[model samples]
Each structure stands twice: as C-alpha cells, then as structure tokens.
Target: MEHKALWTLKFFNFDPSKTQNKRRRQMLELEEMWLHAYDSSRSYKEQLKSKWSGPFIVKSVRPHGAIELVDPAANDQQSSWVVNGQRLKHYLGGEVERLSTVMKLVDP
Candidate 1:
C-alpha cells in the first residue's frame, strides 16, 4: 500500500514545493487575512476552540512571501510581527456592519 501511494505521487509528478510557489496571491494592503493557529498540545476538553485567528489587516506584503499583519481591533500595534504567507489564508467572510459596531468615516 505504501509503494502504491509513492507510485501515485510520482506518476502525478506531485511537488508540494512547486505548488506552493505557484499559488497566486495578490494580498493587497488593508485586506483581511487569517493567521493559522497551530497548537502542539491540546486537551480533549478544548474541542470548541478555533484553529484560525484574524480578519487581521494586511499591513504589508513583503518580498519572498513574508507578510506583516496588524490587528484591526487594536489601535496600538507595538507587538506586530512578520510571518510567512503559508501560515495565512485570506478571510472569506464578508464585511457585515449589522453584526459589529465599528464605523470608518474616513481614511486614516
């Protein structure tokens, strides 16, 4: 079974590295991106926890796929950090003003 799995991958010329490089990403500034939250240690009781965080603002898209993210809720960003694009996925949830009480009157 292991040999068949290897053969299938080889036959399909599956290369995850190349696939990652070929992924089309046009992460514009101020767009929302969710950072993947990975937990190595987990308790069985914590099943309701989320695996992703954000709807974070895309502060900048750096060269070589590095992204700098900023929290939308936090006006002060002294603890902002950079992360690889692989650890993030674009947030698909649309902006719904009815659910939240924040308003942007002008561009800051």
Candidate 2:
C-alpha cells in the first residue's frame, strides 16, 4: 500500500464576479478542457468525473502559483491538467510520490 497526496482543492466554490452569462461560458470552456485532459492523461485506475469517489481518491491538482482559481470548477474545465516535470511529484507526495501511478487528478 502507498500513501496518497491528500489535496485540499476548491473547484466547486469561489465566484469570479464576472457577469453571470460570461462566467457560464468561461466555465464551460474550463470544464471541456478538464474532461479532455483527464480522458487523455490520467491512468485508468483513477476516476476523472465529478460523481465518482474511491478509497484511493484522486483530487484536482492545480498549477504552481495558481492562486485558488476564482472558480475552480470553471478553470479546471477549461485548462489542461499540468502533468509535466515536478508538477506530478508535488501532488504525489511523500513516499507514494515515487510511484507515479498511485493516484491522479480529474476534472472536478
């Protein structure tokens, strides 16, 4: 068994204060990107959708210096999961961080 990175991600909350209609459009873009990235990048052992849960859970891993996204749900849906370089290492955490396949992030 391996220790997993327990991330405190906030995708469902936070408001951008943009016009509601524009915000909705922006959110849709983020959502699409998140779904696409998860489908392509994460390992099959992980769940990439909003509705799934597991003991070996995977949460949304944000980019470095990415302040709590105004709307993580929207941002995650628009941007790609930054799965390169030290990014993966940061999320994996501790000893399990060495095992790249142990966990992953999905579009929340």
Candidate 3:
C-alpha cells in the first residue's frame, strides 16, 4: 500500500519550475482583440463560422493574465469585460480581409 501510494504521488506530481516556461502574452494594450466563442454556441454544420468575434480595443492589461477590452461597436462602457489572456487573440485586419476574399472565392 505504501509503495503504491508513493508511486502514484510521484507520477502525478508536476514540476513547479515547468510552469514558468509558458510563453508571454502576445496581445498588447491599444491593439485590436478577438475573443473566442464558447464551444457550446457552435454547431457541427456551421463549423465554418468564425471561432472568434470582435475587433475590440484592448483597454488595459491586468495582473495575473487578465485583460480589459472595449467593444468599438457598442456605445456604452457596460460592453467592456475583463477576460483571461488565453481566451483572446490579437486581431489582424489584413488577415481578416484576406480570409474573407478566400472564403468568397471558395463559396461563390
């Protein structure tokens, strides 16, 4: 029993040092942002729909990997929210334009 318990603990343990090796946030303040949609909101047939939405502006970066974003399409400050860095991606306008062009060619 003791041997089994020791082996399980050793196997399940994570190296604390490894957690520090994660890549730094790619998004920055004042940059355009996109938040990923919830998986439950998507359907299998409409899988081609974009997984991200918004060209929201990055309002501020918070400690512990949270970011504040503002939706340019909305007039009220209530439209803003703080989200974790993992849920966001930097919005690239040129890439979006290129993708739309490609999609038009493929679909029409």
Candidate 4:
C-alpha cells in the first residue's frame, strides 16, 4: 500500500519542464555589470581574493543572453570581450541618489 501511494503522488505532481525560470538572465538592458571570476586554480596566497571582478560597461546585448563588455578605463575598444549574462551581476555603485541644486547667477 505504501509503495502504491508514492507512485500515484509522482504522477499528480507538477512537471519541471513546464516550469518557467524568471531569473534566467541577469540584466536585460545595457548597463554596468560585474563578471564572476572563473579561475579555479588559484595560488595559496591569493585565497582570500574576491571571486567577482569588474564594473565593466555593457557594450551590447546579444541573442540567447550573450553579453559583450568593455573596460571604461581603456582608451581603445580592443579590450572588449563577450560573456554570458548568467555569470554577471549589475554594478549599482552603492545605490547612490542623485539630487541637483540650483543657484542664483546674479544678485537682484
């Protein structure tokens, strides 16, 4: 009886293939993002280093979630490289707020 009940539950359960993954891509629009370091072979001295690198500018967004990145500090566009969107996270610069203040040009 116990084995029969387990079999029935599996048939009624939801299918994983039908489920949609909403978090499939990181950022859709072109913006700054950080690339996860894929270097598994690391030195013993550099064990404490952060795995994520770059606040790289998003040069373009390709089909099938492919993203091209370029170094903002670099003068030429030759330093650009392509990476997957999953391996990247947005670089939202400490979430700083922008506020503008107007000043009088001359005294009345």
Ranking by TM-score: 4, 1, 3, 2
- Give the TM-scores of the predictions, in the order they appear: 0.38, 0.23, 0.37, 0.38
Clashes of each: 0, 4, 0, 0
Taking the tens digit of each residue's C-alpha lDDT, what string does model 4 give over 1-108? 989999999878956655433233435222223222223344532652432354777889999999998876668867777888997876777753447999979978
Tens-digit lDDT string for candidate 3 (6-97): 99998789665555443223443213243233333456436524323568777899999999888767769567778788878777665543
Write down the worst ten-residue block by lDDT for model 4.
28-37
TM-score comparison, 1 vs 3, better candidate: 1
Q: Which stretches of model 2 miss by more than 4 angstroms?
A: 1-18, 42-108
Off by over 4 Å in 4: 1-40, 43-52, 94-108
Q: What residue pairs clash in candidate 2, if any at all?
A: 30-77, 30-78, 31-77, 31-78
The global C-alpha lDDT for each of the candidates, from Candidate 1 onward, is 0.66, 0.46, 0.64, 0.66
Among all windows of 10 consecutive residues in model 2, the one with the lowest summed lDDT is 50-59
User: How do the residues 72-93 of candidate 1 rate in per-residue lDDT, one tens digit apiece?
Assistant: 6776875466878997876779
Candidate 1: residue 108 Cα off by (Å): 33
> Candidate 3, which segments miss by more than 4 Å at Cα?
1-52, 95-108
Residue 38, candidate 4: Cα error in Å is 14
